[model samples]
Target chain A: MAEYEQHDHDHIEHDHMTIPKYIGIFLVLVVGTILTYFAATVDLDFIFPGANTLVALLIAFTKMTCVMLFFMHVYWSPRMIWLSAVASFFWLAIMFSYTMQDYLTRDPGVFSP
Target chain B: MSSHSETGKFHYHEPGLQHQFEDMGQQEESVSIGMWMFLVQEIMFFGGLFTAYLVFRSKYPMAFAAGSNHLDAFWGGLNTLVLIVSSLTMALTVYYAQKSNRNMQVIMILLTMAFGATFLGVKTIEYRDKFNHGLVPVQGWNKRIKAETNAEHETKPCWEVDHNAPAIEHPNPRGEFQWTDCSLVKKAQDEGYLTNAEKIGYFSNGEIDANKFRDKVRIFYYLYFVMTGLHALHMIVGLALMTWLLIVAWRGSFSEDYYMPVEMSGLYWHFVDIVWIFLFPLLYLLGRHFMHGG
Candidate 1:
């Protein structure tokens, strides 16, 4: 039991995120924000309709991932904790998918005429 | 070291360890799981709003685009940056707490609180702008003007891009929500992507109706207010959490053995930031391409 306690301490110490790493992720997030802002200014509809929205969402998703992993320290968390985090997102995706499926497949003709 | 209670059973006494938990590791894991569960529910709470936005936006793309175009991206972007920086400070506070560096912990907490306040300050400016422009959806909730006789209070054309069209008075006599631009409807007419909802929603006698279009735009502004208002409320709660953290850190109450409070609070702060990360683009950036004629 004493050895088990020491092992747990050493395991957590190994997982500690460095201060520099935190700052690095911060810089990445700031750059991602600026990039998304400028990306919105340029007309990307030439690529495809709603292309601009897609690009902006992609950038935002990237920034969110950085925050969740580094700033929130989920990267250093144990397996169960990380699984729960991912599971939350999975559940969110399920909600979005089901809701969107209903809306996207609806016949607008029913609402009008 | 293990001690004995009166009954002679083993009692492991780690600092900050609850009696229910077998060890510090177990205690930390349990608390973290609990916090994550709370955040999961929070995501769903906000997720419902996002679903509403998606449905309406898809139904009336032009209206959503026009309404989104009016939002000041500069202010939204500034708030996004502010929240991101605050998350950094919050993460640093947790870092310093783990190192037993009380002074740095206090300083970082103060910095986090300052940034959180700055974000809320920016929200106040944005909300006030919405009120002044008669963009609030509720009746009698906007800035009311009694008369337009004053030279400085002359009514101006309500263009979608009027934020840059010089200072002009928006006279709202009955404090009703005001929106006059229907250019997106015209554009959609030309492009032929206007949905049947928009067909019935924005037209009267085969002609585009400004009032009908305005009502659709009103939906966009309504979601904008509710989402950002709730986000700002969360930031206020984060500030309160930081204030408590400041007092405890100043008292040097945390060390390597006990910094879970700081970590948990940091988790919450970053979660709030993540929400704004998605909100800024969805609200302010998505429809900007429409204005650029993309």
Candidate 2:
């Protein structure tokens, strides 16, 4: 099994991405960006207040996923690599969640200076 | 190293593996894991700034909205597109590196650098516009602002203040224009906009006296400078890394087996692009009900 895995790993041709797939991902990314710009341009506050920011963030998240999955090869990478990549974001979430606990409740007057 | 390659027991030879590693696969895996670890630290670093920005923006929503309106979205959008294109080129550079296509790899890297430079150029133009409007934060700058604001009381736009025009000094413009909560009291009151006791310049003695309000909006500029300034610094570092990559790549140093440099730098570039992805929307899209004003 170790020998078989080495044979697969040492060959670059076995799992490399083709040019067309990369080009397709690029085009999709461009469209996602344009869609995000349009979403920001139109006010959606009447549907629900803060909907505009909501829309912008959702579209940005979509675009980021595209970059991560295809451009960064997270989709095709092994489980170990995927875990490493996901761990970074998980740690980032922890940092944000804990910091915001203190930040969101702080009195406005605390920043008067 | 030569003996290990001849024995064929090591799939990846000793030259690719440092003495401490069992083999090249282990060495490469650790390197990959290490890069991700570094990127995690980077995310946390930027997370602190974003958190601070969020807290201030929540506390001062209207001020933030007004600040957001002042930024031009078209240029910000253009930068977003440019950065996305740069990421595409960068990813392609990595692809070509893995294929051992030296010329295409070099070309893609140069194209990425060009887009990065273009992003910086657009940013410089935006910064220059802000300076011309006297929006930069400098100590004692509000003194000039007071004279300029008072001079503009005669239908002159504060942004259009002439250096040659005679200066009229207003007593305590900082205190006069800025109060505890009132953003534009004298101007808003004159414009017949009803205000609560906050906009009114009242001291503890019940007498109307300027205490401090003119510089509250400057906080927005302070945040803007810190965020975009750090971003520009990152672009500078990315450019320097690209220059080194260019030299080594031109020397035919990268190939299918040795493409770690290209892959690592591509990760860094995409990370920067992702940062801009968040920034463009938050800063440029926030209170632009429509600058077209149609």
Candidate 3:
């Protein structure tokens, strides 16, 4: 194990996230949650239809980014790790878009007898 | 290398390091990548359900709105907060593990488990509330009240109340899924904005049928139960993970040189938190504005 220690001192990288940083992220997440909760109370369809859903989703996306980057440590991970992490979302997008394309493009009248 | 093998040790040996790996860094990398791949698959697993939700919600938005309107956002929001705090504790557990602070590691793991239990506890309360209100989608699964003493209260839909607010009860005779509010469907019909799916789904012979609308709302609750039930199942697994982590951490098994287990489990805990982050807004918050005179 001594050789392992040598490599650790020489090659291994540690992110060493500070307590304050974690606390900051936690506070940000809490605020985001609160914002999402209250945002649903206001009828923002006057501004634009589905504005509330868009805003909530936007906030959720932001919060998810923070968790994945900082909490999950993708921010400090290697390039390949970043690639794999991002690839999941990329594949998810494809799944969502392709499925939505099929559902959204169907002629409604075609189903009617 | 032969001599080292005879001595039951290798030149690159580290605690928990497998013989196949040349060094700890290689092992850590391989394990980390493996965990990420597993999580990616998990995302896709839940993604299918999400797509189903999107499709159905887009088709029968009024039914979704009415169903979502009844979910106590207060309980859902509180659970979100509980989960976030647990994630913080989990992250701290990883930090302490890397610091080789055994006591702190044990404490943090315990705290994480505590918060996880709190989340599950809150879910139990919400599920029980659903049972009392006959919100469980499956027939004969909810609390059954055969009497008609609840006739006056039948028409009254419960307002979404904040934390610690007393739960209002609804009576169901046959212990079936019940959705009394059809106001949103009526509004859509009156506004002439009903989608094609809704035009057929909610209407019976040119009139809005309450039972037909209830079926659509049942779809919403079905998705709700499946998604959140799977999430809760994950939390249960997470708690089981913490149990293992706690035992090892208490034995002082992890240290600065070998804390990969802690880190990997932290990834899992945080991933669950991320899922809840999305689930909260989608399941509880999205359709809320419809309740406010929309």
Better of 2 and 3 by TM-score: 3
lDDT string, candidate 1, A1-113, tens digits: 34434524632442367888888999999999999999988888789888988998899889988998888878878888788888888888888889878877777566432
Model 2 DockQ, alpha carbons vs. true complex: 0.39
- Candidate 3 docks at the CAPRI level of medium
Better of 1 and 2 by lDDT: 1
lDDT (Cα) of model 3: 0.86
Instruction: Give the C-alpha miss distance for residue B99 in model 3, angstroms.
Output: 0.6
Per-model DockQ: 0.59, 0.39, 0.57
- lDDT (CA) for every model shown? 0.84, 0.69, 0.86
Alpha-carbon RMSD of each model: 3.2, 6.3, 3.9
* Per-residue accuracy of model 3 over B1-294 as CA lDDT, tens digit each: 111243444555555666677777787889889999999999999999999999998888888888887888999999999999999999999888888999999999999999999999999999998888888999999999776653664443322223255654556678999875677776677767788889999878987777888999999999999999999999999999999999989999898878898999999999999999999989888778878335
lDDT of 1 by residue, B28-119 (tens): 88888899989989988998899889888878888888889889999999999999889998999998988899999999999999999999
Give the alpha carbon lDDT tens digit for every residue of A10-107 in model 3: 32476659899999999999999999999999889889878999999999999999998888888988788899988999999999999888887788
* Fnat for the candidates in order: 0.63, 0.38, 0.66
Ignoring the other chain, what TM-score does chain B have in each prediction? 0.91, 0.74, 0.90
Q: What interface RMSD do all candidates show, one decimal each?
A: 2.6, 4.5, 2.9
Itemize residue pairs with steric clashes in candidate 3. none
| Candidate 2's iRMSD | 4.5
Query: Which ten-residue region of model 3 chain B has the weakest summed lDDT?
Result: B154-163
What is the number of backbone collisions in each predicted candidate, taken in the order shown? 0, 5, 0
